[model samples]
Target chain A: MHGETAPPPTGPFADPALYTEITQFYAWHMALMDEGEPDAWADAYTEDAVFEEPGRTNVLRGREAIRASITKRTAELAAAGTVMRHWMSNLAVTPQPDGTLRATYYSLAMRAPRGERPDIFAHVVCRDALVREGERWLIRHRHVGIDALEK
Target chain B: MHGETAPPPTGPFADPALYTEITQFYAWHMALMDEGEPDAWADAYTEDAVFEEPGRTNVLRGREAIRASITKRTAELAAAGTVMRHWMSNLAVTPQPDGTLRATYYSLAMRAPRGERPDIFAHVVCRDALVREGERWLIRHRHVGIDALEK
Candidate 1:
């Protein structure tokens, strides 16, 4: 909840279409990431997007930077012969005056080794800012707060 | 994938408002359930709703039956001093000609014992049919398939 500095918009949010699109976007986005498609997964972000994971090192700026990180992670997971699934809960979307959207949700990064049951890798809260680009919405910013690491 | 008898509709889905409303519904629904609100949690279902979990015994029919189960589960979890969070993934919504909606999603039941780290309790796929009654959507039928119990 950004206070008076960036108070939320009051009027009714137009563009109900974004609700479906954004929600579906995430479902596809996470599915692709889990399926190990780095390029396609990172494509959901804008050219100048910012991705920050406070618990982890490095705050990646720009799509290429994010793509590189995704590529590295994909390779690491693949080499380990593991399956990772990202689960989301309590997704709330808010529309801003500048035609941007803020989406917040709880995420669980589940990890499953070959021939083993999946376990919780990380529990996190994600706050993402998205902009409409062409026919779809793209993430302009993402901040993930790790639940376990939180003080 | 139901074949023949209950084939999925192919054409574009009408009423995009439902996309936002139904997605938000689950967000609130799961939150209420996790917070141990039985009556409110069961209020999202129809009077004669059918709830089924193949791995678990008993196919509860009617809202009262579902409410009873929710109440019992809520008490049991509270008595054990545990916090249960349900996480969903890959949510897909389809609209039918009769104005009903079918939503399918992967769900993980995570259990946290007091301050301990959370663990996956059950991994499940839920196929639910929701119908509109006046102002809001209500669950008409829900069939949960447990991954671990699957043959």
Candidate 2:
């Protein structure tokens, strides 16, 4: 199951390997973010990546803009020194026959800034992604929704 | 890759394959719900599954109770003929050496009942799952937080 294409998978997806690859892609990306480099998190996406969060009319676009946004978040986290851990589940990876992959998953980020107990900061939106560019899959677009963002 | 557990490669996880299996498990489970089978959706979880919606203090537990709650929801959907689709992404799956999988993913579910413009229904809190059982993974526990829920 390494690099070689498998048989045609049934039920809306062709490649099962795509699912494994995209899932691994996310695991690696998030791990980088958790390592405290938000810039690396933002850089994991395409240069023209469009990032959106809930309750904000503005959609941050491009690598620089995305980096700026992440930098601001990192700054905030640095000030608070909160240990935030993101939890994700229920990922839906749908594969297109053309070898491209589209996936969605559910996530929760538990933010425990300082000495406070960890609280559920955001119920988030897991957006669809296009995975290509040889072996490495980068997120092309992302839109995050806040299910509940109350402090 | 269909059952090939070759020592479980390491990537911030002791059993990465469990993560993938659990992800697909939830995917297949939710897909059953989207296909209008809420009974199966409720049945997919364990007897002690937990479900919580933000802003409401009530928590749903147990298989029968969960089924009842889902049945109620299904009844509403049946009456409304609402078509719901959950998009999930950003899955980070970390497997403990013990084989229990801790995973997270972000999700967005849009509901379009009776042809109205699809509205973002829930920005959700997705938590890590404990996947047990030999090849198939089940959501042993699930905690949901609503960052935003459709009014």
Give the top-scoring candidate (TM-score): 1
By summed lDDT, the worst window of 10 consecutive residues in model 1 chain A runs over A1-10
lDDT of 2 by residue, A38-121 (tens): 877886788887777757548888878888877787788777787777766666777667865667666667677667776655
* Each prediction's fraction of true contacts recovered: 0.26, 0.16
Q: How good is the docking of model 2, as DockQ?
A: 0.12
Candidate 2: segments with Cα more than 4 A from true spot: A1-16, B1-23, B31-69, B74-151
Give the number of colliding residue pairs in candidate 2. Answer: 26
Residue pairs of candidate 1 with colliding backbone atoms = none
Residue-wise C-alpha lDDT for candidate 1, range A33-112, written one tens digit per residue: 99999999999999999999884759999999999999999999999999999977778687888989998777887788
Q: How well does candidate 2 score on lDDT at residue B7? A: 59
Q: Per-residue CA lDDT of candidate 2, range B1-151, in tens? A: 3357665564654344444555576577676676677666765566677766558547777767777887787788878777666767666777667876776777777565442434567888688566575434556677676787767
What's the distance in Å from true for residue A76, model 1?
Answer: 16
Cα RMSD, model 1: 7.7
Q: How does model 2 fare in lDDT?
A: 0.66
